[model samples]
Target: MHIFYTPDITQGTYTLSEEESKHCVRVLRLGVGAVVNLVDGKGGFYTAEITSDNPKKVGLLITDVKLEFHKRNHHLHIAVAPTKNIDRIEWFLEKATELGIDEITPIITDRSERKVVKDDRLNKVITSAVKQSIKAYHPKLNEAISYHAFMNLAFEGDKLIAHCIDGDEKSYITDLVQPQQKYLILIGPEGDFTPDEVNLALNKGFKPLTLGDNRLRTETAALAVCFEINYLNR
Candidate 1:
């Protein structure tokens, strides 16, 4: 069945946006009475049938609704530094959404090569991932903020920081993670977090996290954390 992202959906008939309408009526050639699935990205999933196959404004009648569809037990929020190559960060967003992330914030660290991020473009990537993965909830992408500002924000969860600093004892995520709890993790830039930055996070009550012995890139590290958290929850 074809799945469409319809975040504003409510009860009764609904209209697809012009873009989705064209894709449905023209590209997919779906006609009236065609059955399709819709996800509101807020834990609402609907089964609908096309009522008007207009190529510019296709309409549908919602037949069934499911709320809180496939809800996860925990919330995973990753604050990662944007990679110099924008594609890498975008890739991380896509994979993380599929793997189950509740929130994402692009943090700018002292060694970060990329400081600015276009939220609009990155959001589209996350939305596309949500549909592709048949997810009922959309991941929230926060505006890019400096590492210091992110640290000051109040978060009630298992706080962790992943870095490459040596001589500091770091625990594997599997050991520290507790199922059914909120988690906030910080992943630094390519050069990794400066010693001072690490110390600051530690002072803020964030624990050291180690992915493994081998070093990973900024995006890779973020995805690793996403996968690890989802795996532990599963």
Candidate 2:
């Protein structure tokens, strides 16, 4: 089933945006009375039928809708420092959305090479991923914030930091988080979190965790913990 992102769709009748209209009518050649599906990016899945094949504004009639589709047992949020290579960070955003996560934040750290990020572009990548993966829930892309500022946000359940620094401060993620619990994992940049940053997080009650024996990049490590959390929940 072809799925479209229709955030503005109402209960009975719906009109596809110009972009979606063109893709449905001109490109995909879906005509009137055709069965199609939609996602509202709000944990809603809708099955709709094309009522008018206008190339600029295809109209639809809602046939069915399912809420909380593919709902996960846990809410996973990963806050990581954006890499200098923006492409790598973008890749992480895309894959993480497909794998299913609740939220993502770009942590600005002292060791960070790229502090500024374009949220619009990053969100677009996430939307594309959600549509491709046929997921109803859209991952929330939070604004970039300093590592110091990020720790101040109020969050519930597991709060973890994935760092490579040595000493008796880190546990493998598998041992750290219990299954099916809300979690937020912080990942640092290519240079890793500063000694002071690690201490601050630890002092704030953030559990120190390691991905595995091998050192992984910021994106890889964040994705690893996300995967593990969802894996363990199953």
Candidate 3:
């Protein structure tokens, strides 16, 4: 099925934006009476038939509508420091969306190599991932914020920090996470979290967990946590 994204739908018809219209009419050659699917990226999927095949503003007559519920009862939020290699972080976003993540936060830690990210570029990656995976909901991409600032925000779920530090009470992430509960996992940068940062997270009720014996890059750890959550729930 050919799917397009439009956040706004009104009355019994939907209009595709200029870019989408061009793709539908000029590129895809979808003409009037042809059937196509659309998603608002807000859990609503619409099945419509083309009314006018105008390449600039294609119009569609809505035929069917479906509302999708969250696949998993739990919400998975992963906040991690942006890696120096931007491609790796983008790859993580793609995989995490396919694995079913609710939200992602780019955090700035003391040892972080990259500080700023282009939101538009990152959002496109997310949108493409959602379409490729045929998912109705789009994971939220939060703006970059400092480690301390992120800690101050209220979290209404299980919060854990994945660090490489050796300690007596370290537990594997698979064991620490509970099923069917909202979860947030924080990952550090290449240099990892500083001593003070770890202490702050611990004091804020964030459990320190390990991914495994082998050390992982920032993006790898983030995706690993996402997979573990889905594995346990499945």
Candidate 4:
């Protein structure tokens, strides 16, 4: 099934954008009456038949529509500093979306290597992951913000901070996470979080948790925590 994305779909006839039209009529060579699927990335999926094969504005006749409900009982939000290698960070977003994440925020920490991020590029990676994984729900992607600013966002769930700081008291994320509960995990940059930053998170009621024995890269740690939370929820 070839599933395309469109934000709006009305009754009778709908048109595909130039990029989608090209894919359907030119690349795929889908003719009139061909079966195609679409998603609005807002919990709506449709099964439609091609009405026109125009490569500039392919038309479709909506045959069936299915409204998908939010499936997960728990929410997993990860906020991490973008890595110096943008590809690695993008990889994390893809894998996390496949593994089922509700939210992602790019944070700017004191030791963060990259301050600016291309939201459009990252959003495309996320969309591809959702389609590839055959998932109806799309993950929420927040614009890049400073660490201190991100902390202020209202989160009605368990909050955690993962850092490489020295502390005798540290619990594994798997142990701290409970089933059917909302969660947010904060992963630091390559240089890890500054002492002041860790203290700030602690003051905000964020628990300090460790990923594992072996030290992991920024992306690895972020993905690990995302998967671990998903596993526990299941």
Least well predicted 10-residue stretch by lDDT in candidate 1: 1-10
The digit string of per-residue lDDT tens for model 1 on 77-167 reads: 9999999999999999999999999999999999999988999999999999999999999999999999999889999989999999998
> What overall lDDT, based on C-alpha atoms, would model 3 receive against the true structure?
0.89
Which prediction has more favorable TM-score, 3 or 4? Answer: 3
Find the 10 residues in a row with the least total lDDT in model 3.
65-74
Per-residue error (Å), model 3, residue 165? 0.8
lDDT for every model? 0.94, 0.90, 0.89, 0.89
TM-score of each: 0.98, 0.97, 0.96, 0.95
Q: How much does candidate 3 score in TM-score?
A: 0.96
- Please list the residue runs of candidate 4 whose C-alpha ends up more than 4 Å from where it truly belongs after superposition: none
Among residues 3 or more apart in sequence or in different chains, the pairs in candidate 2 whose N, CA or C atoms overlap within 3 Å are none
- lDDT by residue (1-234, candidate 3, tens digit) is 888877787548888999999999998999999999877778888889999999999999999888873456789999989999999999999999999999999999999999998889998899889888887888999999999999999999899999987673778866787789999899999999998999999999999888878889899999999999988888
Candidate 2 worst ten-residue window by lDDT:
168-177
TM-score of 2: 0.97
Q: How large an RMSD does model 1 have?
A: 0.7
Give the Å error, residue 107, model 1: 0.4
